[model samples]
Target: MTDALAIATDLMPVLARHAAAADAGAAFPHDSVRALREAGLFGLLVPAEYGGMDGDLADLVDVAAVLAGGCLSTAMIWAMHCQQVDAVVRHAGERLRSDLLPRIAQEGYYLASVTTEPSKGGHLLTASSALLPEDDDLLVRRDAPIVTGGEHADGFLITMRAGPDAAPSDVSLVHLHRDQVEAQVVRDWNAMGMRGTRSVGMTLSGVAASHQVIGQPGGFRAIAVDSMIPAGHLAWSACWLGTARGALDAVVALIRSRHVPSSMSRDSELLRQRLARARIDIELAGGYLALVRDEVLRRRHSGQPLDDRSLQIRIDTVKVACSELTFSAVDRLVQLGGAMIGYQRDAAVPLERHFRDLRSASLNYSNDRLVGAIGTMTLLDGAGRLP
Candidate 1:
């Protein structure tokens, strides 16, 4: 295993140990986060010169999948943080890069995204909040319906209109240190699963230096199209796969430990066949994820633009397919394990937690929206037979 994957593997027990309690209380996994920080995973995507691993998308996928097997919430937090890091490393000005990247590597500074706005919901391409000039800095007061890991983020990458009069699509990304922002929790996070994410609704008032604006004014569309969307989809898909794999492992263990009577031998065989089918689904989802990951890495290495219609369609399809496939696989595994093992909260198997968490995979990004978008893109591309 690569060093990054090994570190993530070693930390799995730590994440698993606290996952239940964290999920029970809907609390952040402090111990798990601490373990990840100490392991230097926060710098997984940072450049080597910045004291990071200098890892690529493949590394992120492997590490995220392993970590998610232990605790989906912790893995998701790390994945989202890495996504923000990618944006900063690629688009942020020299000043912001110099200030945040090193700290993120050495001090394990966690970054949070503040993109979703109340008016626009999950329509991240546009922003309703505008950045106003204040003396020597830019001031922004934005409210988001959901800010994942917001309460614990050391920094924030916020999206806003370039100015009061700028068009909604004329968005800019600004970096704000936690100290520069005053955040008020507007809604508590009480969810069915992935509760440890602490995705609370909050109103944030912050000031950022002029140099902290990443890329150019009205340039956020490019950043999202090029970086955020792909990274988020890939990482989220990995987590869903991991969650399904974890449950499958639990179900297998439960089956192995039980002794079936000869009269039920045929039933046992049927159960094994069902399990095999679920495993096949999981493998298919994983294969597709790997394929997309390699394609993305190839484009990045060759300095090829990622905005190609075909590539975008593949990325979106992978997300939709993986989320749906993994969720279905986990549901089947849960059924095979039966109610006593899968449905009981205190059962030896943890399939119940996995089932609950995986359910959110489809709803988080809303597969319907993605499917509609994919269809529109395909229809608009006259040169396309298939993407």
Candidate 2:
């Protein structure tokens, strides 16, 4: 196994042990996060020169899948953290990169993304909050409807209008340490699933050094297109697939451990068929994830533009497909396990939790919106035979 995957594998028991308590209390998985930090998994993507492993997308996929099998909430928080890390690595200026990347590598500084604004709904490409000049520093005050793991993050990567006069689409990404920002929790997070994420609403006011702006001002569009979308989608897909796989494993184990009644041989055969179907769905989702990962890696290595139409479609489709397919797989496993076993809160198998967590998969990004966007892109590609 790869070092990253091995590290995540070793932390599964710790994650599983705390998963139920964290979910019950809607608390952040502090122990799980501590274990990951101690294992140095936070530096899995940092460059080697910065004392990191410089792992690739495949490594992320493997690690997320393994981690999610233990606790989907913890795995998702890790994935989101990695997404912000990638942004900093790819777009941060020299000063910011030198200051933060090393600290992230050595100290495991957790980072969070602040993109969704109060009035903008789910739109992430534009920002209503503007960065105003304050002497030598840039000042920004913004309110987000939801900031995942906001309370636990050591730093934030915020999105804002490039300047007071800039258009909504002229956005910039700014980094601020927790000490640099005055933040207030505006709303508590009491969600149906993925409770450990603690994605609460917050208002933040911060002054960032001019050098903290990632890439050029008004250049966030490129950053999102090239790095953010791909990283977030792939990592989330892996997590969802892992959750479904974990549920399947749990149910299968429960079945094997119990003695089957000979009188119900026909029903037993049907259950086996359903399990086989669930396995096939999981396999198909995993296969597609691997294909997308390889394609993304190939493009990055070849220095090809990631914004190409064909690849963009594939990236978006992978997220939608994996989210739907994995949820379906878990749903099948839940039904196969039946109400007495799967629906029980304290059952041997944790299918209830898996079912609830996977329910958010489609709504997280809204598969309807993605499908519509994909359709528009497809219509725009008049020369498209196949991608």
Candidate 3:
């Protein structure tokens, strides 16, 4: 229920302080996370009864976009936590919900997901971990690469296969508690950008289970289709939208501050074209996000099921468009910027971080796979469409 701009204001200074260290040390943005929790973002997805915002996807988009304006890594980490809570609300049992909801809502506990597997090609399809019957608890081990928020997460929304190899395969989303899971920062993430997210590789070996099971075994796809697709797509789009917005602002400043300026009529036609086209691309993606989000709020969040194949196609298309557009805008900004923004956190630093972070959008295996799935569905009469 917080005003969007207020949230933006709360994060600006917090993002700047840790923005340097995050990239320098390749660490999680602990200060920015503290700021987000103080701003009540950790509870943004849980129910109001438990002192959470109980926000819709539109609210999520607003908060995420604002946070991305400040720090992309912090924003993306919160996005993962947002998805974790959303899944819990839909699929957790009463015992699980009752035990954890209040604790997280009040304490601002950090959360993340450990889903990408080594063999399954960096997505849900090939989960190597198995949740077997271990007397009263579940026993599971998993290997995940590029686990966002892994280094300091209190827990993870782990996706796993169930039963023995000969047993019927069941996929479940289980909460791997901190005590039971071992999340090591195995590799140094000296990337071109988004250093604060601490996206690292995780090796979970026979971890103990926690509350919140996202539906029955072998149901990862259902959890994704039902609870995650709309929300995650919109959230990442908003994150990149923030990046595009920052780039726009930076380029405008660049134009104004530089010598041989446009006002002197010395601005090259090429530069003007790049700026104008970047503007159009950003605005188009913004419009697409706004339009689809309204539909999501009016239909998807109104207790209406989001199962229509056509609607799913719209979701995939919009995601692909926004991601592609944002990346293009960043590229344009960098091309126009030349050598000025090559370094870290300064006038040029935000664009540098944004450029690197924007790449994560389409590179997400699940998101990319959806693009192809939607195309085949449109071309093949929805016979084997995977949404």
Candidate 4:
């Protein structure tokens, strides 16, 4: 077993115990974060030389799924952190790597991404921030629309235009420490789901050295297409599946304990059917997830990034299917569970919380937008024979 999976397994029970409280209070899962940091989970994607696990895609998926089964918020935080970690590991310069990766692995420094901007109008590709020449360093000024766990993150991968004269595509991903960037929480994170993510809007202004930006100018587009989409899509899908599995586990336990046959109202054979459907849905989703995961690992081992449109389409399909199927499983399990599933006070069931968290999957990037993108791709390319 990978260190990520092993450590995550040990953290699951503790995370589950506090998940309800985290949701109820709409607070960051600080305790869970602490445990993860201590376990070196924050550096799961960093290299072994940097004191990391040097874990593969399967390891990332396994750890994410396991954490999601216990707490969606914590799982998401981990996923976001891993995404940034991937960027740093794959694109960052030697100086930045030497300065940051080791500390991230040993000091428990959490990282978050700052890609979306208020002025960009929700298009993640466009950067609203301008990088200005200030002697040896650059001055970054812009407001990010949302920064999940921003308050707690030690730093952020701030996406911005390379310079004032740069084109829209000439963007850079800069890593700025908290002391360097001023994060003003512009909007409170009182959302209907994923409350523990603490995804608040923040106005940012910072200064970064030239080396802080990963890769060369205009390289962010490549990074987004190659690393960001695949990692984010796969990890998020696995986490969603984990949440569904947790709900299904609760439903199964409840049914096994009280599902008596005969004239009992809740003991219909249809109840078993509902449970079976939930299981099958999760299984089907898991199978697809595993297939795609294997492909991701294969390509990684081959030193080829998943940059092709066909692979991207496949990744999007996996994300959409896993999101829908997990939501379906949780919804079905809740319906079969009846009134007890609605109990707000019980942390053991977590049915209602699961429902709320699962709802965000479709809205994460809008399944509608992906469907449109896919349809346009199919129309243009003919969807003819993918390897």
Q: Give me the candidate number with maximum TM-score.
A: 2
- Candidate 2 Cα outliers beyond 4 Å, as residue runs: 259-267, 382-387
Cα lDDT of model 2 by residue, 28-83, tens digit: 99999989988888888899999877988889889999999999999999999998
lDDT of model number 4: 0.84
lDDT of 3 at 110: 76
Please rank every candidate by TM-score, starting with the best.
2, 1, 4, 3
Per-candidate TM equals: 0.96, 0.96, 0.89, 0.94
What ordering of candidates by lDDT runs from best to worst?
Answer: 2, 1, 4, 3
Count of backbone clashes, every candidate in sequence: 0, 0, 3, 0
Error of 4 at 77 (Å): 0.6
Better of 1 and 3 by TM-score: 1
Task: Give the clashing residue pairs of candidate 1, or none.
Answer: none
For residues 45-143, could you state the per-residue lDDT of candidate 1 as single tens digits?
A: 999988899988888899999999999999999999999999988888888888898999989999999888879877778899999998989998999
lDDT of 4 at 199: 91
User: Between the candidate structures 1 and 4, which one is better when assessed by TM-score?
Assistant: 1
Candidate 4 lDDT over residue span 197-282, tens digit each: 99988988889999998988657888887677778888999999999988888766655666532322445888778888999999
- Candidate 3 local lDDT, 296-337, one digit each (tens): 777855777766677677777778988899989988877766
Error of 1 at 35 (Å): 0.3
